[model samples]
Target chain A: MCATCGCSGNEHKLTAFLAMKKPEALTGLTVATLPPGARPGVQSFAPDTPVKTVIELERDILEKNNRMAERNRGFFEARNILAINLVSSPGSGKTALLERTLADLGARRQFFVVEGDQQTARDAERIAAGGAPVVQINTGKGCHLEAHMVHQAIRQLQPTTDSIVFIENVGNLVCPSMFDLGEGRRVIVISVTEGEDKPVKYPDMFRSAQLCVINKVDLLPYLKFDVQALKEYARQVNPQINFIEVSATSGQGMETWYAWLGL
Target chain B: MHELSIIQSILEATTNAVQQNGKPGTVETIEIEIGELAGIEWSTLEFLWPAAVGDTLLADATLQVRWVPGKAVCSDCSSSFDVRRLYDPCPGCGSHLLQITQGEELRIKSLTLVDKPTVAKAPLRWN
Candidate 1:
């Protein structure tokens, strides 16, 4: 019985063909060409012959991606670059806050932006308007930007040493939490329009974040959202979570926000 | 969802294992260990496994996912306990400082393959 699809046994076949019609490809190739376990000395069994064998390979599934992330971290450390991963849900004003940040601190420090989205270079354009080099990575169907994508973006942007690279992750509260993009710190941005329970609702994102920016505090008087309650909820999820309330529109509390970034 | 991508990874890992050890037959069983904190949906993985592994060496392979429970150690009290959620506090100390020791596992443990049987004929009487 086919456990996955409930298909009968007659259709599913495990037989594979390793046809090397061009033997020269094999002769000239080094050990790198073979799949990990099929190294030259390590035995490779044919799938056509009937012999019961168990292959023991205790390997981490995310190890490859994590290794790439470590490589990115090494790159960042070597260059003395402060990489910050900005995560939040859609319409959380991440872009507006970033715009204010670049304009206010542009003269003090160099900035590079790695904009991630499912479509459009719109965010990249906005960041570039603020006089920073930006690389936009369209993830297509991917929900989050992986470390490798950020590494590629860094190669393209090549921000100078001691510069700050802000990686604006895809507007997702869940998927981006599991991915480590070699950032020195993770900042989660939330707006006043969002519910105070957002931290508890998406505990993973809040717990992984080092700082939380409660954006759009200027509208606090008109809205029913309680800022203190939101902070308390966030703290309940992450005891070490630091907060900065700001409004990108009115430029409220942006100084403290910049100060947190050591700008 | 990202489940599709994860399934692809699992398929790639399985293929590598099969190519290394499978003996000219079919894969019988594949055992994978997934922890509670791996953030994968079990039903979604089960739904996508068939289409993802179809036409590959992992076709018809029995996928056995061993779910590992999340375990953590409290930094303040040094008490070990189960972690049901990301924000779960230490039972003894109520501290958020926790070092997760397990349950983030996403690994392929082993695979069983049945190769083509090599039948032995009676030894030749005449030399």
Candidate 2:
């Protein structure tokens, strides 16, 4: 079982790949000694070696995920749906912010949520309480939600056209930034308690995000978190990233967030 | 960590490549390119490489990685520079508006497969 999420660790096993392996034939193979300090992109083999064949494959490692993400993008565009991916570290208040948004704008807008967590359907339950259809994806041992996962969730939710879909990705600062879920906008949330240097520490997440939501502003006075420094640091990484400060509990800056959402 | 997942993807891609080549005996070497800004830690990837490929076809494969440096062009000044971090600013105008020209590459460049040798035919005995 996974120590972090309390689920079996084989959730992400690609069965097709596993099944493709043939029994090993370990006989009659000549092992050549490679030159010391040989590197890729440099010629390391002799042309006369008839036993070896080099296959050139300039393939992207994330090509499969990228293609799936593009398909999801096309699906969302054809239906005129706006999909937003919410990403952040654990306890950055992504679900809380979504709850406030669904509660405040449910009457004015059609909202659907695809909540992602390593375990439990608690976030989905909270989203359902707000009257918007929701689908919960338990990633098991998977650290981040990939495009195919989101595609499956979208299918299960069956959100209507001209609606908004919020994909609350598994709360991770690093891994989730590597996978694109075909969201129209990627938002990174940071709370006052997490400190101002988060952007610099996790530049990849900050750089990929289009918007930065500074949560828990009500506790700003109690902590020494410098909001300006955080914005400056975030801008240093991503100059075009927008910011919205809010306290979901007190509804401090929910209006600005709503306006940013155009709801 | 995510490096394990990345390695899994690498193994899967390599496995598919081998299958496409009519099930080459074994992967001898796998060449890959990883950019400086690909959001991967080299140490972490290297650390997890052994165990991730232990049971796969790549278990005995020589893993070769080509490191690509991050490069970006300043949108404001049209100046190009090598980037070490995402927060790097334009040297010409000190502006943060920059367009990434290169880096962020995570690719499998090539694979070398060794075919098993055929059994030697016995010379006909002359009586």
Candidate 3:
């Protein structure tokens, strides 16, 4: 008797029974007859028999995304757009910084925004209210934004030439680090409320970022967050990273931030 | 997880390769190389593999992975060292200004395929 879905003896009966009752088991069955002069236990390939072939690819797994990003880069370069990708952990005050920046420099520069969130149009609404054209991308179950999504957003927004496009990435630090959004600069936002060791803990984000914005400086007086230590840690991970300390709510250091933006 | 997306990309690439190669044969094994600094969790990838490859060309194919270690060279001291994490400073100069030389790879190395019996096509030519 067979061990699984027991059907004894006759080979044809056993195959038919398993095919009807447990079709998956049929996959493991070798019902084909052997070729002439082929031994039962030993294997031999005839001169004309088809053989296994190994195809060497050695191709990057993210080739598709990288190609798309290059296309985006070309698009931005042709239009003279300064594309900035903002990445951070959730509740790190990315929207607040954008809101303050838009409010302060709305008269001086033309700004376009691409907001990414797991689910919501709230950030896009806020950007629109600030008088800048914006598009919100709901990733559904996606943890990070890809270049293709930003390309689509740019098409929808139809940003003019020589403008700044701020792509506020989905508020996740891990997965976003691996994706290149073809941005002119990649800024990482971290508030004083979070741990000072965030840089070392999530080194990939800091290592890839060009600018590190330390937000919520207004709340520094009440908290034990060491600003110097945070800066040191960030430097350890990324020696070339520039820092700009700001409090979006108190409007402190906004001028420096604007200056960094060349506005 | 990002690994799921990576798996999907692998599947798409494999499918495209098969189509481009004139629908050669059924895949037997796929070999991949993942670096330590690639930002992928191997455990999560393993756990999600079956579901991600189900009903795809890679369903019955065996996955063979090769892990690559991280390596970096310090700019200030001009010394090379093994890097396990990006936060690791240069051992010689204690400088953070290090250039990564390796261990960021996420690539498909090769695919082994068992050819179909009916097709008598010429051998594939590689440049």
Candidate 4:
């Protein structure tokens, strides 16, 4: 039975990735390791008098995640950390954009990145090459980055107060939107090569994001994507959403993007 | 698949619910409420139920999922209405500034369990 809620069940599994060199830095840090669930049959037995009992437990299944998210939120608030969760589909140029951002302001500002992927640490390597302290989280079989994982990553990174921390979620549009990593802001990246109606198709992602970045704009001259129509579609879903078009490769409209970040 | 993980969570939660009651009995019925905006596919969950609970305490337990439709309220005009999708606009004001009032629920409602036999059912002799 769960101590928080009177539910008797196995614990949901999670995997946390942290590489400690000295091992002393790990002191005081309680890493939530997600190591890795099924159904069973019913056995009926003769009872003297069958007693049927109904237990009312209006417990939210996702409550555990939410509770961890609140803790993360408090941690960020106490430290004055600006944690941004960047989400989008695979190949949406999330890493490319991050590389550019790091290369541009890495020397001026102390930025720490928590890179989430299903398998490799390639993205983390790229961010490090671009001149930023980065940690890689490999969520094997897990579709999205849960708050508990982020909390562990934060403890490992130990980002400086008032510094910027970017949580590049696994390239998924659906599941990442549902799980909040206690980010100060959520930015959804959409490329011109993708369908313009993505906002409508993935309404939850667009609705939850505070900003929508239209990446790969340099390819706009070649591709037949309607930029205005895409923005209009996004607005139909979230009236208060902000947008910025940029080409991470050509550095086009990067200043505007940086300005929005208040760097 | 994410659905697989969701099934695991359900099984774990149900098991916990059963143990807390202090009665030895396999689960008879497990009821859960999932809202439309909760981002779960009902058919998929239903399809994965059997394999998920194959040999656990709830193997023969009946699974009941109550789907709650998405609903929202218009922040601009204070209009309450049912929302089919997150992008739905206010019916009265047609404003995108709508606050979600309901839906997006994923919870374990209740569990029904049968008492397990503690001793043989033979008639008790007068003491």
- DockQ, computed on Cα atoms, for candidate 3: 0.34
* Per-residue lDDT value at A247 in model 3: 98
Q: Is the docking of candidate 4 incorrect, acceptable, medium or high quality?
A: acceptable
lDDT at A185 for candidate 2?
91
Task: Give the alpha carbon lDDT tens digit for every residue of A3-66 in model 2.
Answer: 4234465232111111112234223323333443443322222222236778898999988888
Which candidate comes out best when scored by lDDT? 3
Off by over 4 Å in 3: A1-50, B116-127
Point out where model 4 deviates above 4 Å.
A1-48, B118-127
DockQ for every model, please.
0.32, 0.37, 0.34, 0.32
Judge candidate 2 at residue A7 and give its lDDT.
Answer: 42
* Between candidates 1 and 2, the DockQ winner: 2
Between prediction 1 and prediction 4, the one with superior TM-score is 4
Q: Distance from true position, residue A173, model 2, in Å?
A: 1.0
lDDT of 1 at B103: 88
Of candidates 3 and 1, the better by TM-score:
3
Winner by TM-score: 3
Backbone N/Cα/C clashes per model = 13, 0, 0, 21
lDDT of each: 0.83, 0.86, 0.87, 0.82
**CAPRI band of model 1?**
acceptable
* Model 4 lDDT tens row, B1-127: 5566677777777778778888887688888898898788777777888998899987988888888988888888997999988887888988988888778888989888877444322222232
